[model samples]
Target: MKVFEPVVRLMNRLKYAQKFIVIAVVFVLVIASVSFILMQRMNSEITEMEQRYEGASYNTALKDVLQQVQIHRGTSVQAWNGSEDAQSKLASIREQANRALHVLNEQHTKQTYPLHIDEELDAINEQWQAIAEKDRWQDRDELTTLHTNLTTFIIETMLTVSNESSLQLARSPASQNLIATLTKTMPSVTENAGNLRWLGASVLAKEGDMTAQERAHISEKFYLMIEEFATIDADLQRAFTDPDIQAAVQSTYEEATAANELYATMVEQLLNGETANLTSAAFFEAATNTINLQFDLYSTSLAHLTTLMEQQLSELKMNRIMLVLLETLIVLVAMYLFMGFYIGIKRSITTIEQAAISIAEGDLTTSIHLHTKDEMLEIEHAFNKMTTGLQSLVKEIGESSQYVTASSEELHVGVEETTKSIMHVAEMMSDVSEGANEQTARLQQSEDALQHMTNDVAQIVTNSEDVAQLALTTMTLAHDGNDVMQQSSTQMNTIQQSVETTQHMIEALHGRSEQITHILQLITGVAEQTNLLSLNASIEAARAGEYGKGFAVVANEVGKLAAEARNAAHEVGTLVQGIQKDTTTSVQLMGDVTTQVRTGMDLSTTTAQKFEQIVSSMEQLSEQINGIIVNSSQVASSTEQVVTAIDAMKVISTKNMAASTEVATATEQQNASMEEMAASATELATMSETLQTLIQRFKV
Candidate 1:
C-alpha cells in the first residue's frame, strides 16, 4: 500500500500541544477559587468590628452626672436666708449630692488609679453645713464676714478641681485652655459676689436719708449685681457636681494614666483627650456634649472632640477604599496572566488539530516541528521519524513488484514454445497413419485374387476324371471317326498353359500387398503415441495462467491434429477389411476356371489312346473339342475381372494419398495460427505490466 506523505505529517504535528492546554486550564481554576474565598472572609470580619464601636451603652452614663451638680448649687443659695423652703432645698441638695458622689465612687472603684479632685469636692460640701448652722441669727457685720469666707472657699475649691481636670485633658489643646481659664477667673467671680452682698446691706440701712426714687435705683442695682453673681456660681457648681461631668472627668483621668502606663506596656492604647480613642474622657465628653453643653466651658471640649471623631471615621473609610482598589488591581493582574496562558495553550492546540486533519487526509510529508524543550517536542520528533520510515518501505515494495512482472513474462514465452513443438509432432503422426491405411487396402485386394486362382485349379482336376470316362465311350465308337480325336487333343493342350500363368500372377500381387499392410500397422502405432504427447502439452499450457495464454492456443491445435491421426488409423483398418472380402471372391472364381482346364486336358489324352478306334469315335471327338473351347473362354473372362479389381484398389490408394496431403497442410496452418496467438498473448502481457508500472506512482 502507498502511504500519503501529508497524512503522516499531520499526525506528527498535533501530539505535543494538547498537554499544555490541559495543565494551564486546571491551574487557573484552582487559583481563582481560593482567592475569592479569602476576600469574602476578611470583609465579614471588618463589618462586625464597626458595629461594636457604634453602640449606645456608653452614651447614657455621661448625662446623669451633669443634672446632680445643677441641683446642689440651687440649694446653697436658699440655705443662707434660713427659710423653711431654703432648709428643705438644702436637704434635697445634700441627698442628691450624696447619691451623685456614690455613683462617682462606684465609677472610680473600677479604675486603675485615684481621682484626687473628689476630695476637694467633699470639702466644698462641708462649707454648706456651716451656712446651715448660723442662718438668720447672726448680726449683719458678722453675716458679711461669713458670706465672704464661704464665697472664697467655693472659688478656691472649684479652681483646684478645674486645674486637676486640665492635667488629664492635656491631649486636646481646647480642653486644656478651658480648664486653665476657668481656674484664673474664679477669684474675681468670688470678690464681686462679696461686694454685691455688702452693697445690698448699705442700701437697706440708708433708705430714710434718700428720696424714694434714689433709694429704689440703688436697691435695684444692688439686687441685679447679686443675681448675676449667683447665676455664675450656680453654673460653676452644677458643672462640678454633675454625674456626667464627674464620670467624664473620672473616666478621662483613668484612661490618661492607663495610656502613660501603656507607653511602657508591650502595646500602647491612645489616652483620654487623644481624639477618637475608644476608652477615653474625650470619647465620653463627645457623648456628654450631645446632652449638657448649655452653660459650661466643657462644651468647647465636646465640640473639638466631635470634630476629631468625624475626621478619624472619614480617614478609616478612605483606608478601606484604598485596600479595595489595591485588591482589585492585583486580581486584574492575575486575570491577565491567566488569559495569556490560556491563549498560548489554545494556539498550540489549534496547530495540533490542523496537523491531525491533514494527516488523516493522506499528507505524510508534513512534520511536527516544535521549538519548546518539552515532552511535546519529543513526540514531534518521533512522529517525523515514523513518516520517514513509511516512505522508504513504500518505495521498496514498488521495486519488488516490477521484478515479479518481468519474470512472469519470460516464463509465459517458454511455455508457448513447448506447446507449439507438441502440435507439430501430432501433425506428423496423422500423415503417417493415412499412408498406412492406403497400404492395408491394397494388400487385402491382392490376397483376394490369389485365393480365386487356387479354387479354379481344383475344379479343373475334377472335370478331368469325367473326361477320361467319356474317352472310353469314344473308343467304343472308334470304328466310326478318327478326325474327332485329333481336334480334341489340340484344344486340351492350350487350356493347360493358360491356367499355370494365371496362378503365377496372383502369387506376385499377394506378396506386394502383404508388405504394404505391415508398414501401415507401424505408422498407426506412431500416430497414437504422438496424439498422447500433444495432450500433455495442452495440460501444461493451461497451468500457465494469463502468461501462457499463447501456449494454450497452440496446445489446442495439437489436439486437433492428434484427432485427425486417429481417424486415419480407423480408415486404414476399414480399407484392409474390404480388400480381404474381394480377395476371397477372386479365389473362388479362379478355382472354377482351373477345374475346367484340367477336365479339357483329360479329354484330349483319352482321344489319343482311342486312335485305333477312331473310325467309330470321330463324331464324339468333335463334340468334346467344342466343350474344351467353351471352358477356356470362361477362364479368360475371370482373368479380366481380377485385373479390373486391381485397378480399383490402385484408385483407392491415390485418393488416400490426397487426403494425407490435405491433413499435412491443415496441420501446418494450425501450427502457424498457434504461433500468431502466442505473439498476441505476449503483447497483452506486456501491456498489463506497463499498466502496473503506471499505477505504482499512486503510493498504496
Candidate 2:
C-alpha cells in the first residue's frame, strides 16, 4: 500500500486529457466485467431453474408411483382379508398402477437418473408384481414387508434425485421445505398409512381375533404416525414462511390434516382392541382417504414450487436482456460526452493559438473569448485575463510617472502651509494639556465608582439567578406532584368501577337466593300433595280388604318420606333466607363503598387540577425571576462597558498631549523638506519621458 501511494501521487499529476482516457478505459473495463459476471450468473440460474422444474416433475411422478403401489397393495390385502370383488378390485388397481408407472418412467428418462433410479425402479416394479401375485401372497405380514420395502426404495430414490437436482439447494428457503414435503416427509407419512392399511384391514376382518403381534404392529405404526404428525407440521410451518407458498398449499394442508386425524382415530381404536366395532372395508377406505390426502398435499406443493421456479427463470432472462440494454445505452452516452469534450477542447485550443500569436507580436489588446461549459473554458478565461492585465499594466505605468511629477510640486506647497498651521497648534496645545490632565483624573475617579456599582449589580444578578433556579426546581416538583395526583385519580376511578361491579354481582346473588327460597316453598307444597294422595289411595284399597294391607304399608312409607321432604325443604328455605339477608347486606355496603370511592375520585381529580395550576404559577414566577436576573445582568454589563470606555478615553487623552508636542517639534523639519521637494520634481519629469516611450510600443 505504501508503494502504491507514490503511484497515486503520479496519477494525480497526470494531465486532464490523460485522466479522461484513464476514466474512459476504466468505464469500458467495468462494464465488460460486470456484464460478463451477470451473464454467467444468469446462465447458471437458468440452468438450475430448468433442473428444478424437472425435479418437481419427477417428484410428482414418484409420488404417483407410491400412491399406486400403496393402493394396490392395500387392496390386495383387503381382498385377502375377505373383501368383496377381490379379483376385479385388484385388476382395476393394477391398470392404474401400470399407467402411473409409464408416466414415472417417462419422467425418469427426462432426468439424468442419478443414484441408479432406473435400475432401482425396475427392482421395485418387479417386487411390486411379485407382491401383487395374490396366489403367491401368504399372510398380511409378509405382504406388508414386501410392499414396505418396494415403497421405501422408491422414497430413497426420490431423495437421491432431490439431492442431485436444484430442489435440495434451492435459492429460496420455501422451496426447500416444499420439496421436502413432496420428497421425503410426505412419502414416509403415506407409507406409514399404507402399513396401517394392510395391518388394519386384516385385523378388522378378523374382528376380535387379532393376535398380540397384530396389536404390536398397529402400535408401531401409530408411534411412527405420531412422530410424522409433528414433522409434517414443522415442515409446513417452515414452508409457510413465504406468503405466496402458504396461500398455495393452505387448503390441501387443512384437508390432509383432517383426514390424518380421522385415520388416526380409527387406528387408535384398533390399537385399543376396539377393532370388532370397525368393518374391514370401512378401515381400508379410511386409510386410502388418508393416503390420498397426503398425496394431494404433495402435489399442491410441487405445482406451486414449479410455478415459482418458472417465474424466477423468466425474471433472470429479463434481467439479462435489461443488462445488455443498459450497457449499450451507457456506451452511447459516454461516447456522446466524449465527442462533446473533444469538440470543446478543439475550439478552446484554436482560440488560444490565435490569441497567443497576436500577443507575441506585441499586441497587448489580443484576447481569447469562449462560452464553453467545460474545464477548457478556464483556459479561455485565463488567456483573456493575462492580455487584459498586460494592457492595463502598460497604461498604469504610463500614467504613474506623470502622477509623480505633479505630486512633488504639491508636496513643496504643502510644507509652507504645514509650518504656519504647526505654529498656530502650539498655542492651542498648552491650553489642551491643562484640560487633558484634569479630564484624565476625573475619568479615573468615575471608573472606580462604576467598578463598585458593577460589583453590587453583579451580586444582585447572581442572587436573582439563584432564586430563578430555585423557582424552576419548585416548578419541576409541582409538575411531579401533579402527575402523582393524576395517577391517584385514575386509580380511584378504577376502584370505583370495581366496587360498582361487585355491587351488581351481590345484588344478583341476593335475587337468586330469594328465588331459591321460593323454589323450596314450592317443594314443601308438592310433598304435602303427594302425602294426601297416598292416604287417599290407601283408603280406596281398604275398601277391597285383602289389597288394603299392601296399600296401607305403601301409604305409610310414602307419608314418612313426604314428612322428611317437607322438613328438609323447610331447613333449606331457612338457609336461603340467611343467604339473601347476607347478600343484601353486602350489596348495601358495596353501594356505600361505591359512593365513597366516587367522592374520592372527584376530590383527587380536583386536587390534580389544583396541582397543575400551581405548576403553571411556579413557571410564571420562574420566568419573572429570570427576567429580573437578565435586567440585573444588563445593568452590570453596561457599567463595565462605561468603565472600560472611560479608561480608553483617558489613555487617548494622554497620547493626544504627547502627539501635540511632537507635532510642534516636527514643524521646523518640514521647513527644510521644501528644498528637497524641488529636486524630486526634476527626477520625476525624467522618469515620465522614459515611461511614455515604453507605452508607445503597446497597442492598448
Off by over 4 Å in 2: 1-22, 38-46, 82-84, 112-142, 166-178, 353-366, 386-700
Question: What is the C-alpha lDDT profile of model 1 across 1-700, one tens digit per residue?
Answer: 2476765566456543443344444554555565456555544433322321121111111212323333333233323433356457656655665565456445444433233545544554455455445445345445445545554554554444333333223333443333333344323332432232233223322322334654454346334434543453444345445444344444433443343233212111121112222322232232222113222333333433334434544555666676567656766676677667657656655665565444334354655665657676765675566445434433443343344345335434532553344254334435333433533343243434323432432343346554444444433434222333344334334433433333333333233234324433543444454455445545543542442344345445444543553454345434433333333333333344345445434533543453443333334444665453354344335434434433443443344344334434443543454354345335434543543443343333
Task: Please give the lDDT score at residue 596 for candidate 1.
Answer: 47
Worst 10 residues of 1 by lDDT: 52-61
**lDDT tens readout by residue for model 2, 1-700:** 8989976886789865786777788888988898899889888887777777787788778888889988877877777666677646888888888888889877777664353466777886787677656465667667767878888888887887777675777777777876766777888989888888888888777765778887887789888987897799898899899999899999989998999999999988887777666888888889989899888888888888888888888998888888889999998899789878867776677776666656545476876677776775776676666566656644554454344335433433443343343334334434444444554555455466556556656665666546555555545655665665566555555555655654565565555555555555655665566456456545543542442354355445555555655665565556556555555655665565555555555555655665576566666765566565655565556556656655654565455345434433432333233233223333333433443454466578
Which residue runs of candidate 1 sit more than 4 Å off their true CA positions? 1-33, 56-364, 422-426, 429-700
List TM-score per model, in order.
0.32, 0.50
Best by TM-score: 2
TM-score of model 1 relative to the true fold? 0.32
